[model samples]
Target chain A: MGNSVSEVQTADDVLLELRNLRTWYPTGGGVLGGGREWVKAVDDVSFTIKRGETLGLVGESGCGKTTLGRSILRLEQPQSGQVIFEGEDVLKMPAGRLKQVRRNMQAIFQDPHGSLDPRMKVRDLIAEGLVVQGEMRRDERDARVAELIDVVGLRREHLDRYSHEFSGGQRQRIGIARALALRPKFVLADEPVSALDLSVQSQVLNLLKDLQSEFGLTYLFIAHDLSVVEYISDRVGVMYLGRIVELASAEALYDDPRMPYTQALLSAIPGNERASGRARIILQGDVPSPINPPSGCPFRTRCWLAQDVCSELVPPLREVKPDHFAACHFADAI
Target chain B: MADGGATGGAMLLEVQDLHTHFHTRAGVVKAVDGISFDVPAGGSLGIVGESGSGKTVTSLSIMRLIEPPGFVASGRILFRGRDMVGLSEREIRGIRGNQICLVFQDPMTALNPVYTVGTQVAEALLAHQDLDRKAVRERVVELFRLVGIPAPERRFDEYPHKLSGGMRQRVTIAMALANEPQLLILDEPTTALDVTIQAQILDLVRELRHRVNTAVLLITHDIGVVTELCEQVVVMYGGRIMERGSVAQVTADPKHPYTQGLLASMPTRAVRGQRLAAIGGAVPNPLRMPAGCPFRPRCGQAMNVCVTDPGLRNPGDGRSVACWLY
Candidate 1:
């Protein structure tokens, strides 16, 4: 579970691999409509999550980080892609097989208040997955639920209480417990600590890290907070409007970012002492609409280094440095 | 005593011994209990805290926007040497958007979606000023440009929904600056924007403050933002100020236990894989607050003397800390 970069890993080390994923939503019309625009929420995204390592995906809202996570989990059906999990294509799996595969993959949503069912008791909330899987009896489920509650730093008494009765942090703990109830190998935590208070935020982050080590689980940590992502991620990926702009080990990406978009993002962090004395790059406008994203390169509109070639041809994500991939035309030149 | 009021010459906003409370059926909740601070002319002060810290209540109290069941119980809100606590509704309305303006986090809620953003900003200007329609249009366009909205003329007639979140925030800022208010109160202004958009907005705010020379009262939970914008800061917790000092002094060398705890808990301050020194336990339940120091229950340095309130005491360096350890 140590956060070391395995330079020479066997093929067995790979747990989840996404190949050319495309999740598009038609806007303003039905399928029969003549003038329908597709919002490419996750446009041909490809990445992998190794065993027992956290892959942090950083992006602005509507930058397709959430959509990408959802698409990988098959929560949002992709238009086309291969969600290969342990040598099996989940996208091609039948409903029954998909249901079985889902037990190994779980999701923790952003809002604790909205994610947890307020009407259900904590015990049932955590046990619902186990109950659905039906691998354990009632007594076993009860014991597992009890054990999960304790593991997540919640007391046995909290099992009887409803979600509304608990604090935001506690509710998030309940959500975490629920996500971990089935002992999933890969967990997609989307902004898990975003809604929490500063003091409470650290507690949840620590819990997530501890759980990862204890259970030997891999994680796809998706969040907008750069600092939080850097703290937890072994490798980090920067996503711009529906595409992975840059991906590298956390140290490499932060120290010497290849893509202009990645550099701009790092500079945008408020009071980043680590990158002190670095010039701040405040992008002029909001992200372009995903429905009609800038052609060739999604980030070309806001990129400071944009040129004619940037708009004329798409920049393929290539290894510009050792283990560091970037999709900018000037990645090598810069 | 509100020492800050005496230090900063020509204090534009002085909140002294402010106690804003909510009189619900259960009991009274002291949302802002005896918080004192000052914002000098053209100076910026950040009120930093997490949720339930009374920072928002203090801003609302200043704006007189706290509704029924919640009222400013007692406090001297001296705005430009005028006591605003007992001002009549009609009297305060004259000063509300004219002399002081408020820009909150969500611009969508602040703006009227039915009307065009231009009309909303023009309306804000017309409410406090006597201007012709042509002049209003010109001023609105100018304000929009000043807030960094591109194609100001084209965007003038667009509805709030048409603008992006950052553009909507710029519109809100344009409205806030319509009357050239002396004091601007922003509550978590960039909390809802993307990091890059947030950077843009922060730059806009800094530039506007320099150009307009308006005193600012910024309420936010992010320490990085406060350190970047504000000269002075007041850290709040459980409806009271835990520490007050220059941003450099407080942030670099935090005095109070709560202040230290808050600064220590920030993920930005830690390296990768390093465990953060988090403050244990949740914020106190407002309905059932612990006696004396509200933070004592979770304080690592709790002492017997903490049973009694350690009111704001200056240890040294002109920084006031509300902890017995000082």
Candidate 2:
């Protein structure tokens, strides 16, 4: 009954595939006013999430990692893209059918404080999705809510209390419970543990892993912390200026990065004394504005390997290794 | 018993038996309860702890920045052997930003959005230094260049929103450096910046440490950053010092159970997929703190005698630990 989004067949094992997704927000003015500029939040980013796979999107803030996750979930409408979910086009689904699409996909926002409604009880907060979808009767929803609360490591008493009563980690558990209440096959977690303490962060991460195995869930995990992403994600994608600069297995990307940007990012992780001997390539300056990005390659401004050709040609995502892809002009050379 | 001051020379900042409390309607909350540490001159000290560990409040106490309901009840905050808690408002104001500057995490909040970056830097210099308007402009431009901000002249007039996160951080650093403070109290200075940008800022701080010879009090929640910047380390929990030692001694061989739990929680360079050893429970509520050890509920090594809280006594290798095991 929960598997309603698989409307068509692409004859592939991947659960979600996004092709050239672009989500831009217009800035400045409108019709009878000055020319408007578009902040290319998610510019032509393309990737796939296999069934039961966790694809970690890593980048600094303003790099559009969150926008990419939101766009894939259709939370933010993309200007143009192919959001093929379970062989069905998520972007092209009708309003009535779109509800079905949403039933199979869920989102866990970053801020636990702002995400949950303070007025609602934990019971209704978790059961809100099930109630909206009308997937079960009132009694069944309540029982399931109790079960979900227990599954998320919270007590039955917490169900009657408001979100403000719980701790940050407990509130995040409530958020997780709410996201998983509908039994969505895929979940988009955007910086879920960033707000948590180090000790609490590991608990949430462990719970997410346990839930993934128990429920057979696939996740599009978005986070800025490389260490946390490495701990959770099977495969990782490095995004910059609204584009995927590098994509590879977590271990491969950390151990053997090819793209200059990727290498710079990996080197920047504050490792221990053994790793301190290696020289860190601190980028010269901050990321350029996405509204009016640097010409040719968006990352060319900060790239150490930048040559004249980097300014004249856009780098395409090319497979440098067997399974690793890097969007750089000198991918083969590196 | 003889905790009157820094005692020995070469220590730049000494916080002795500090007790900061909040007289709220509910009750008195001992935010910084008898914590003591020292930062050597031209050396950096990092205070690492989770939220409400009194790390922030301890730093605030040092700055004499505590306000009405919250006050430093009793403490000796010696800056270059001068008493901070005893200083008058006007006297302390002269010390602040002139000999002791603060660098915070969120740069956007530090820099006034209404004014240009140039104006902010110029204002700090105008307050502290004896520079004329023309000299202040030249010095602001110089400070920006010193902070490695690209095209200092062009970026001088840019508002906080106009610059990216990293550039905004650099501008705040420029303002902090305008007065050449002997000790820089950086409260999670790079926590809000991107990791790459954080690397840049740390490298900049390392270089400036030699150039300006300024001692740094780097307070953060991240151990990796503590290892990267500070030589001395203090671990705080429930507004008390759990462990204090050289970073090499404490981080490499953490003595306190809480310190051990905190270190084990972090995902290291180990291969992916390994489960992290998470601490069992959350930090206890300050209002309803457990009778003995603040971390007893969450501690894996809790014993029967843990009900009696222990004092921070030195174990070997110039390190102090507050645990029964030690």
Candidate 3:
């Protein structure tokens, strides 16, 4: 299990590989149609998720974490990038092939109440994907839906219930069952437990973990909660205003964070036992608008050890330690 | 204030048998049903619970702000030994901002958009105090500074839309502190802010509370926040107090089953990659809560006696629990 976080077998075994991914939303501040500025939501982001591993993505609001998840699934079109899955560049896939790609890659959204359709029954909701993508008979589809409900810790009788009739935790389970209906090799769960209550959050989280192991799934788990991310993730990548600032194993990121942004984020989590004794590195001001980020390092404006050079040059994500990478010019010196 | 419980201190606010109900068309939703607790002077009391747990309603009832479908049906809200349950609207107006202040969740909705942040804070002072316009302006700047808002002079003129989420919350706090109230009620104030911003706001609140010696009534669903900002805590579930004790005792050794579940469910506290011990079942429907214990459906340690409501009883070590086990 420890080896899973530090190293995967090989690049050939990589389930998903993103290369120089750039997803930007054009703002209409300048010209009506032409000279639009980019929000730079996911600016030059890249990462890899191997089979049977969860890579946690974390950042503050508007840091482009959610945008990156949406971009990977192609829910939001990227201006340029390569999302290579199973040796296939999904971004370059034609419409016919892209539809096929969708079957292998699925998403579990944040909102349980809003994500599940109210008009649809629980059975239809779970079997919707299979009905469209599979050649299975009606009874086979029904059997699969029942199997999914049982796998997600719900009873078979629950298939007849409406989504609104279920609790938050149950609704989330239904969402998960729906995502797994197509038997995706990779699952992108975007804040799956954020909207749930504290106790219910743990239930959904545990269910997701159980299903991940049962199905041999790969996940790009995205959230703002550092603690939950650390708990569920093998490796983590910290985002800041549309760029990955730190990438490392969960242990390394928590035990020793090199980037100032990562340090601030770790220190910010309340009730970490060490929180009372430690001095928190509070970042001043709010996250800057993505339309026009700072001159150089996005975090330089809030970095405690920010030097003049920090604002002059963008720091690249470089390996500073064994199996740990941080995007800071002075990462080693720190 | 009944000084019978743990960590003996001057009693600042005491809520006794408070039942705040909502007379909706569906039925009488007992949002807060016969709940009681005590807050020490200059100390913080945390009302920890999930949604529909009556935590928010408790605070609103204290502020005499429950409107329309919701009303405080019966309760004794003793603030400095004064019964505020039946206070007239005119009387509450004088005491609302002057004696006790409230800063609820969603700073955007709390603050007026058209008006500048300065005007909103000044309005609090103008309503309760007899300070002139110039003094009000000076104090507004000071209040902003007290809440750690940068460049108070410049921020004073800025509209609520211009300031960020954390900044708007600071302004909201400044307004709440306009008259230096004896008791400050915060209802999930930091839930909407980012985690870093949340830490900053909580720090500012702790520092301000100590400086002004204002007792705090903090309401939140996150046990982490409660542990950070509170001394005493009351765990609520389905409009009832499931457990009440000092934060130290409860977090260190939670007696109630519900409290134990909440503590174990915290992702930070739980071990990495391990399944959290989540409490099963949702809160009972507010309109049609169970005739028995409200938490029985979700309680892992439910005994046969849970079929009936358990009264609050002392289980030793200066803690009170409402359960059959106690």
Residue lDDT tens for model 3, B262-296: 88987763488667888887778899898768988
Which scores better on lDDT, 1 or 2?
1
CA RMSD per model (angstroms): 3.9, 3.2, 4.1
Chain A TM-score, structure 2? 0.95
TM-score of predicted structure 1: 0.96
Interface RMSD over true interface Cα atoms for each candidate: 1.3, 1.4, 1.5
Instruction: Give lDDT: candidate 3, residue A81.
Output: 78
Candidate 2 chain B weakest ten by summed lDDT = B1-10
Off by over 4 Å in 1: A1-10, A273-275, B1-8
Candidate 1 per-residue C-alpha lDDT over A219-279 given as tens digits, one digit per residue, 9 for 90 to 100: 9999999989888899999999899999999988888899998888888898763336788
Which ten-residue region of model 1 chain A has the weakest summed lDDT?
A1-10
In model 2, the fraction of reference contacts reproduced equals: 0.75
Question: Which digits, one per residue and each the tens of the lDDT, describe model 2 over residues A80-129?
Answer: 97888988888877788889779889999889999999999999999999
Residues A230-312, candidate 3: write the lDDT tens digits: 98999999999999999999999988899988888888887763553656777887888898899889988778899999899
Task: Please tell me how candidate 2 rates in CAPRI terms.
Answer: medium
Best by TM-score: 1
Query: Tens digits of per-residue lDDT for model 2 on B1-326?
Result: 01122234578888899999999889988998898898877778899999999999988898888997999999899988888999899999899988899888899778898999999999998887787888888999999999999899988888889887778888999999999998888999999889999999988887788688888898999988877777788999998899999888887788898888888888765735767888988888787778777888988888998888888877877898888887
